[model samples]
Target: MMPWLARSIYRAQEAALKRPTFAYWQALERSQWLDRAAVEALQARKLNALLGVALAHSPWHAARIRAAGLHEAVRAGELPLADLARLPTMTKRDARDNVDQLVWRGVPGGAFRYNTGGSSGEPLIFHFGRARQASDAAGRMRARNWWGVAPGEREAYLWGAPVELNKTDRIKTLRDRLVNQLVLNAFAMSAPHMDDYLAALQAWQPKCLYGYASSVALLAAHAEARGIKPRLTALRVVCTTGEPLYPHQRELIGRVFGVPVANEFGSRDIGFTAHEAPGGQMLLLSESHIVEVLDEAGQPVAPGEAGEAVITGLSSAAQPFIRYRTGDVLRLAPDAATGGQGLHVIAEVSGRQTDFVLAADGRVMHALAVIYVLRATPGVAQFKCVQHAVDRMEVQIVTDAQWNAAAGAAVVAGLRARLGEGVAIELKLLDTIPPEASGKHRYVVSHVPLPAGLMVTA
Candidate 1:
C-alpha cells in the first residue's frame, strides 16, 4: 500500500474513535492563558486530590505518610513542600523493588507497564493507569503548541524506540498520518543513512520538526558540510528533546534548518514537564507536574540557585511519584517581571548525571564536551566513547556512505585534540552501536572512578 493511502485510512479510524486530540488542545490553551495565581490554585487542588488517593490506595504512600506523622486531611495548599522531606524520596530502585505496593489498588482494570532507559545505569519497570497516560499526552500537545504546531498539522518525529513493522505498528502509523506526523528512525543516524532521512523530510514537507537535540544537530552539521540545502519551506519550528540543547547546537540547527528552535525537557516516566516559550522563557508546565529544586542536603534551594530536580506527578495514579528524584542537575531562573509565583524558570540543565568521562589526569569531563569536537569533524556518523583504562580510550564510529581511512583518522584526531597528548586513542569501525538493555543510546561510558571531591554541576 502507498504510504499516503495507509496514513489516510489510519486517520479515518482515529477520528471514528474520537481520540482526545482536540480536547487536549483546548485544555492546553486554557492552561497557557491562566494567571499565576489560578495555575497555583489548580495545582494545589490536584495535589490534594492526589494525596488523598495516595493515602487511601497506595501501600507505599500510606506507610510513608504514617512514618512522617501526616494525616489524611492534609490540604494541598497547607501541606508544606519542605515537609515532604520527612518521607524518603522515591527512586527507580524503589519502584522496581515494590511495583505492586506502589500501585493504587482502586485503579480499575490493569495498569500500563513501561521500562525506564536505565540512562543512569539501572533500568526499572513501572506501571501507571489510563488517566496518567492521557495527561502525559496532553502535556506533550501543549509543548507542541509552543512551536505553533497544533493538532492536524504536519510534523516529523525523530525519536527513539523500536520500529516494529507489525500490525499494531501499522495501525499506529496510519493513525499518526491522519494527525499529520511522520516518524523517522532515530536509531539509524549513520552518515550513510542520512541521505535517506533528508529525502524523507523533503517528501513529507512537515510544518515542524522534533527529535533528539544531538541527533538533529549532527544531521544539520552534515547538511552544512555537504552543501545539501534541501528546501524545507514547510518547516516553521525545530524542537529538541531527550538531551540538553547546547548554545552552539541550538544556533547551528536554527541557521541550517532556517527555523526557530525550541527546547523541551521531559522524561517518558513523567511526560512533558517544561518547554521553552516563544519569548525565550523556560516555562514550567506546572499543571502536569509539581517541580522542586533542592540542594545536596535535600533542602530547598533559593531561586536562581543550581540544584537537583525533584518531580511529583499530578496525573500519575497507577504509580504515584510523590517527590520522585530525577538524576539531572538544573539551575533555576530568578524571578523577573513575568509573573514569578514561586515558579522558577530553568536557566540551564545538564543531561544525565552519569554521562561523564573520567580522565587519567584526575579530571572528569561531560560527554557532550567530547561530542562537540567529534561533531565538528566531517564525514562522521554515529560514534560512542568508552574509557578502557586510566590512559586508554576507544571510539567506535559508523562512517558515511563513502567510508574510508579518512573518516577513522578524523575520529582519532578529534579525540586526541580534546583529551590531549600521551593518551592512547583507538578508533574501531562498527556496523552499528548497540543500545543499552533498556533501549537507549549512551554517548560516553567510563569504567574508572571519578576524581575525589568532584561533583556534577546543574
Candidate 2:
C-alpha cells in the first residue's frame, strides 16, 4: 500500500497497456527548449505524421485534406495556417453524422471513445488510444509539477463522475487511496453536504487539490464563512478546471486555502491547452496541441486581438481534430519583444456559452457580472442561477453557517441592478447542486430557446 509500490504497480499496468509514458516525458522535456521556430519545426513533423495517417486510413480527412490542396510532402509551417483554415470546422453533429468515416480504419480496435459533457448543449463522442491517454496524463503531470506537486504526493480530486458502489468501484477507490487520491463528488456542492467535503479534506490531508473552479470557490467561501479553516497545511496548490476561474473566485480560493491557485483551460476533447505558470503567466502548451485564434470570418486574429479558439490535437490519431472550432473566446497576449517562452499566452478566456442569464430587457447577460457580485458578497458558499422563463429566475444558494438575510438582499439588489425590476428573483437553499448526466457543473441554465434578437456585443 506504500505510495511508491502503488506507483510501480500502476506503471506496470500502463506499460502492459502500451501507454507511451517514456515518450511523453521526453517530448515534455524537449518542449522546455522550444522557441517559436522550434515549435514550428515540431508542429511540422506532427502535421506530416498526422497527414500521412489520415490520408492512408481516414476517409473523411483523406478527401478533405486533398480538396484543401494539402500535400503529404508539405511541411506544417509550409502549409500556411490560412490554408488549414479553409477546411471547415467540424461540429459534434459532423462527428455523429460520420463517426465511422472520421475514424482511421487502419488503427486497432478498442480505441478509447468518450463523450464530453457538452456544457454548451452539444455533446460529441471522440476517440483516442492508450498512447493519447498516456500523453495527456503526462502533459497534465508536467503542469502539476509547476505547482510543486509530484507523483507520490497526496491529492484530492473534487470532480463529478457516476458513483459506482459496486465491487469494481470499491476496488478502484481502494486503489486510488493507495496512490493518495481522494475523490470528492462534485455533484454534492450544496450547503448541507459541504460539511462532509470539509471533513474529508481534514481527514485526507492532501498536498494538492484539483476540481471544477466553481466547486472549489464554493468550498473556500464556505470555509471563510464558518471560520473553519481546516489545518490543510499539507495542501500547497489548488488547480481548477471545468469552469472559468474569475478573478474574485481565484482571490477567495487562494486566501482561504493559503496556497497558490492555478487556472487550467482545457476540455476532455482537446486535453490540456494552457496552464498558469509561475509569476502569473498563462503559458499555452503548444507542444501538445496547436491553437489558433480566429476572427468571425475564420481569419487568424492578430496578437492581442480577441477571437474564437480553434484547436487541433497532435497526439490523437484515433480521431483527429484538425482546426476544430472550440466555441470559446480568447484574447492573445501582447507580443513580447524578447519572446521569452515559445508557448503562446492567453490574455483572458470569456468562459462558456452556457453562463448567460436572461435579462428583464429581453437580452441575455453573461454570468461574469453576477459571479463578480456574489463573490464580493460575504457568507455565500455556492450559488447556481437558473432561468425558468423570461421573467422568472431561481438563485440556489448553499451557505456554511447561517444564511445572512442582508447578504441575500445584497445579491438580489445586484441582480435587479443588472436585470430589470420586472425580473422575478427566487432564493432557494439547497444541500447540494447536482451535476448533469455527463458530469459537468453548469453555473447558469436557461430553459428558454435562443432569442431571435439576442446578440453578443463582446
Candidate 3:
C-alpha cells in the first residue's frame, strides 16, 4: 500500500472510532494560542466529568469517592478540582489489585485491554478506551507541530517490542510502511545493527525520529565511531521518551541527527503527559492530563520545587486514574505558562534509567527486553537483572507464593529465547530486592563495559 493512501485510511478509521480526537487536536492547537487560565479551566471541566463517570460506573473509584465523602459532590454534579484532592492517591499496587473493579468495560467507545511494560519493576494490565487513545495521539500531534512535522509525514521509531506481542515481523513491517514510519528495534540495538538503522533512516528521509533517549544516544555514539555522517534532508527533530533525556544525550543526538532533540515525559499507565517545546521548555499536555507535584507529605509543592509526579487522566473514563502516584519526580517550571503557549512546563522529570544488556551473540538490547523476561513471570514480586558478561546473567527475584519450579523454567526459557541459548542464566531467589546505595531501584544493571565503538566520549 502507498504510504499516503494507507495513512489516509488509518486516519479515517481512527476518526470513525475516536470521533472527537481530531476535534480535540484542533481544539488543543487553538488552546495553545489562549492563556494558561483558559487551558486549565477546560481541564477542570473534563476532570469533573471523569469523576462523575468513576462514581457511577467504577466500583473501586465509587468506594474511594464514598469513603472520601465526594459522593455528595458527585450527586450534586459539582465536583470541583479541590474536592478531587480529598481522595487518596492510587498506587500501582492498588491499580493491580482493583483492575476488575476499576475498569468500566462498557465505556462509550469500548474498552481495550493492555499491560504495562513493567519498567517500574511492577507490571499490571489496564483498560483504555478511544478517549485515552485520542488524548495521547492528539497531544503527540500538537508536540510534533512544534518542530514543523505534521502527522502522516514520514517518521521513524526506535522502540522496544510490545510486551508479549505475537506478531510476525512481516506484518509489523508492512504496518510501519503504510503509516510512513520505520521502526528500528530497540530490543536488538547491537553496534552493527545501529549502523544499518542509521543508513535506513537516512534513506527513508523521515521528518522526525522518535525513540528512547538512551538508545538514540547510543546509536549516535556508534555513528561517530564508524565515522558515518548522515545528512537526512527532511529530518526535523528527534523526540526521546521512555526514560530521562540527559544533557549529554541531547547534545549527542542533536549533533548526529542534525536536528533539535526533544525530551518527552510520560508512562504506559498514565498515557501522554508532556513533551519538550521548541522554546527549550518541557511543556505538559495540560489539555489531557492534570499533573500535580506533591512533596513526601502529599502536600502540593511550590512551583520549581521537586516532588513526586501525581497525575490525573482527565479523559480516562474507561479507567479513572485520579491522583495516581507515578513515582517519577519532577517540578513545575517557575516560568511555565508565562509566554510560550499556556502548556504547563516541567522543570525536570527524574524518571527511570537502565543499562543495556549484551547478548551472547554480540547483540546489545535495551534492559527492558531482559526485564520483561522476569516481569511477565508469575513468581516475581520484584526482580533485578545483573549482567557480568555477554553470556552470564544473575536474575535476583523476590519470590512470592506464586513462585514455583514452572515459574523458574519460564524465566529461563524467556531469557534464552531473546539472549540466545548460548547465554547462561542463573536464578537467585531473594527475600527482598533492595535499591542501590543511591536509593534508586535499577531493574537491569550491567557491570560489563560497552565496546569501544558503542562508548560515548563525554
* TM-score winner: 3
Q: Write the per-residue lDDT of candidate 1 for residues 155-191, one digit (tens) a residue.
A: 8987643323678888877767666778876544444
Reference-based lDDT, each prediction: 0.68, 0.70, 0.84
Question: TM-scores across all candidates?
Answer: 0.72, 0.75, 0.94
Specify the poorest-scoring 10-residue window by lDDT in model 3.
116-125
**Of 1 and 3, the candidate ranking higher by lDDT:** 3
Single out the weakest 10-residue window by summed lDDT for candidate 1. 449-458
Model 2: weakest 10-residue lDDT segment is: 449-458
lDDT of 3 by residue, 1-458 (tens): 45467658668868777646677788889888767787777877888788889988999999988998889877776777766789999988888888999999999879998776455476666889898888888899899988998878899999887534566866777767877878888988777788789889988999999988888899888888888888898989999998888888889989888899998888878998999888788888888888889999999988789999999998888988899998899988868554468778888889998888887767778887887677677767778889988888998888777889999999998988888888889999888878899898888899888888787546
Compute the lDDT for candidate 2.
0.70
Off by over 4 Å in 2: 1-3, 74-83, 105-109, 334-341, 353-458
Off by over 4 Å in 1: 1-24, 75-86, 105-110, 161-164, 336-344, 353-458
Give the distance in Å from residue 448's predicted Cα in candidate 1 to where it truly belongs: 18
Clashing pairs in 1: none
Candidate 2 lDDT over residue span 1-458, tens digit each: 45577567667756777887656865786685577777767776776676667767778877887877785444343564435566777665566557788786456534777765344433356787665787677777777777777666788998754323688888878878877788876644444456778888988888789987766776777677777777787887899887678888888888888889998888777777887776777777777677788898888888888888888777767888777788778887865313366777778887553445656554434444455455455565566678787788788876655358898898788767666677788998777767777555566777765343222121
